[model samples]
Target: MNSHYDVVIIGGGMVGASLAMALKNTALKVAVIEPYPIPDARGEGYQPSYDARSTALSWGSRLVYQQLGLWEKLSEHVTPIKKIHVSDRGRFGATRLAAKDYHVEALGYVVPNEWIGMTLISALKTEPNVDFICPARVEGLKRSEQSTCITLSKQNPETGEYDLEPQSVTANLVVIADGGRSETCQKLGIEIQTESYGQHALVTNVTTSKHHGYEAFERFTENGPMAMLPLGESDGASVGCTDARCALVWTLPEDEIDAVMAMPDAEFMALLQTRFGYRLGKIEQVGTRHHYPLKLSQAAEQVRAGIVVVGNAAHALHPVAGQGYNLALRGVVALAELVSEAAGKGENIGALPVLQRYINGRYADQDKTILFSDKITRLFGDTSAGVGLLRDMGLVGLDILPGAKRLFARQAMGLGGTEAKISS
Candidate 1:
């Protein structure tokens, strides 16, 4: 295998794979170093980005995917979210945002994480300019005047252990998209600011007695915020289920997650119904449950002379607003555009100026999104009467005022503020 390339992306998860795809048409040669190998279509083995979890893609993100020529491939697998219903439990405050009001076909779309991973990975395999180095761990990084050298150890496929001797790959640029808890970023001395939300997000798929009508729900309860996103009909039909299937993201106190996870399906559904109410009628069935502690984390520095960190490696936020991946997608788009331009200009893509340009272009959007996600998580998580009152008022205002609804909807759609150059 060639040891030198124009760019090497560390981590081949959603963001990393997206970056590779975004740069496929460019002339620059690229490599992706991933710790885990892509799983076979029939295998039950763990796939990093391809899991049972579902992600909400904002409308602007849909446009970005469309521009990349991937929307058609993914559209069939996704469930269009025609409306978003948000409310505070036991309060009169509620708001609804509809696609018709905004003149958009849908506000957003819900897609399984596996579908995205499979789509991006399959597309990446066809890119002649990209090399995929899988089941390999990046052990060390060295930046020199000419290139960044990455030290890697390949994992034995059968044993799933790194037993090979260290090998090196030198590239003009190195991009880190390894995810929120990036040991590479820490090893490189990149500072990260983190704040635990004292909450845990319990996720699962649930079937409703009534049709979801392609509506997404966000209900703020005393425990925390819960989101029910509509799932594609095919998913339920494949399992011989006729009821509507929706992905549930329920936030609860960290200490209570164990008990909740241990609860039987019927008992759990009953508890979920109590908090979320029967917006789509009774919760009839729930698939496997998963839990993860929540936190807000952001890398203090996202770029340097020869390296740039994108996606969860840069910022991981609470799921309250569903902005983490959308924000990362925007950053990826901005970086890809800048890198392509730099390559076309015969300039060093890893040079400080070029990397700084990427950072400068994306910093404002990142800042605003990080702030928005953090604020929403904190505000909705607050259980105090005063804060609760403010939350109700805010919901009421968003419901009653078209202008306010539009602004919030736009932000949620990832179309608010200055648009990324790639989107334009």
Candidate 2:
């Protein structure tokens, strides 16, 4: 086994990479073990290709990425969502959140996930204190009183598997960011509370006749709420003309998922257009669609002795409001702040108090986001008339009351929560 280090992060995904880059200039020796490479960073000022996947970058998250020096590299690919429109079709319910009203440049930016990953990778490359071991697979994990040991094997690209040749390393703190159902988290005997929503989210990109103009629409249909986020480029671009594009996240019942998947191209497009409405004009072309099963999972405890869980490994919320990444960003920011403060004080960076500080700081924010997302999904996803009316009324009430709207915007932007301030 290798000698003990200050920290060993298990996953090199967005949140993990953010944590590493956040501590890049610090004195702590940090190592990241990821089974896959981060992202390609070779691009001239991010002329973003039409990416199939994207995430809503909240203002709070944007600030963190900016501090990490990632935003400047990929900002051009982002489409600022200047307004968010929320409504239900059958009821007199509508609420609008405007960037100008919030006194910000824009409410948030819809950025391709690939760009975020690429930017994080670019930042990670410049850090000398950070040891990133990717294309390597973790074989085993063992925990001791003082440190946790991780066994890894080099991977073979051809076979798409790991070589048997093993190497071991130990760290004072082991952070599991391997995702929701993390093997390392399970190995540490952490219990996860999971709730299956029995729904599948269908995501795709579509070109519209009318430009979204950086406006995001969230409409509650009978099936579920559909989120339409503006995109920079269309899937099929034409010469001398720009194609207006947006990403659709349609939540469907599990029973209907197979049928939706089996639908012919035209039929599927019709269904999508009908649900999304004509506000964006007729949907001209639909990109390839994919579905993900919905679930809410939260870890019972984020810290234990020498271990800490961050990002999806700590909490997985419904993507209805697109709070998953934003919440993860919050946790990462909090963890980074705690670690930096402790290290600055010349204290043991991986000690129990430091780990506990992260957990205590993140618990309320993560819990609120999870509960709120779950509630939103349940409230709007229901087809019952009575429940639908209540949701509509809530929207209508928020619309009429300016103060309520700002408060809701604050929560949606992940700026105001009961948890400890991450940036301060």
Candidate 3:
């Protein structure tokens, strides 16, 4: 337990696990510290019935998974997003991006968040190079000129109990992938710039009588955008006949969230149908709904003396474009690649300049994504007539202009106009 490792990743979620797995065959030693209970194979399908969280993986992200040999591992649970439909309801015609046009089989894939976590951890359990420590939380972190040392306790960090007896582990590099509220980032005094959107996103799954045909919809309404991402074909044998299900992300004003949630099933369905305008056609059944407050948070900088922030710790963008995980995926890929290169060169893998390269490689794209998502929030959420007109015209222009549409499609898929690049 006293031995040092090449790298320590503080968060065993998707981003952290992916980074660790990517480094598996390399010479670098890896350790993942997570407070939550790791998903065991027996508990794989028994996810919390209350969790309706979902993620839309971009094409670029899919490539990263493929490279890590994970795409095929969890392919059964994923549904392809073949087409993206964007529109301003009650106004201009919608803009569409087709997978065929991009010459890719699909624009992206939709996977439930719980499934994602389970699949990643299941894979990590088999990775020989990784040391998985769960139910173990980090209590304190300090960096020396040569390496970083962190204190770990068996209980969760918040509980302040040292049941396992405090232990110290140092690593050449430390990556903080802790989610939105990252304790490691806080302990390091990393500053975050955040914009709390006065909105709450209600997420769930809905089945329609008609087939979705693998189309993903982003309908901009007065309240906010409502997204319906198609899931895989349902087993036609089911009683609900809900074979064609789609994940829902309905954003509403914070003040209106409770009102919407309190509405009877029938009333709420009616409201959803009206907003989406019969596109999906008759919300036959809706799954359990989960609401989350929306906010845009960006780390002022991602690099520290011995640590580099990754995932939600580094940036948490608005889910309006469903780029939170996609952005995180890009960050994970970049950091892993940079670290691997440093290891290959026999350099001080966690040297300031080495870590700085990782930070510099990540900043531009992360910044653009944060700004793009934040701008979309402000632009559509404003609801002012002038803003409406502008957005409408922009939609129209995007539809008619081929170049603009292409650029928009690339950007939407987390693959454009940024230094931090994720290859697909």
List ranges where model 1 is wrong by over 4 Å. 41-45, 235-243, 418-423
Give candidate 2's TM-score.
Answer: 0.93
lDDT minimum window of 10 residues, candidate 2: 43-52
Q: Backbone clashes in each candidate structure, one number apiece? A: 0, 0, 1
> Candidate 3: worst 10 consecutive residues by lDDT?
43-52
Tens digit per residue, CA lDDT, model 1, 66-164: 888898988868888999999999988899999998889999999888888877877887889999887888999999998999999988877878866
Task: Pull out the clashing pairs in model 3.
Answer: 234-243
lDDT of 3 at 348: 81
- TM-scores for all candidates: the values are 0.96, 0.93, 0.93
Error of 3 at 39 (Å): 0.6
Full-model lDDT for every candidate: 0.88, 0.79, 0.80
- Candidate 2: segments with Cα more than 4 A from true spot: 1-3, 42-51, 157-161, 234-243, 418-424
Q: Is candidate 1 or candidate 2 better by TM-score?
A: 1
Candidate 2 structure lDDT: 0.79
lDDT of 2 by residue, 262-359 (tens): 99889988988777789999888888888988888888888887788888888888888989989888777777778888878987666888788778
For model 3, the superposed segments whose C-alpha errors exceed 4 Å read 44-51, 156-164, 233-242, 417-424
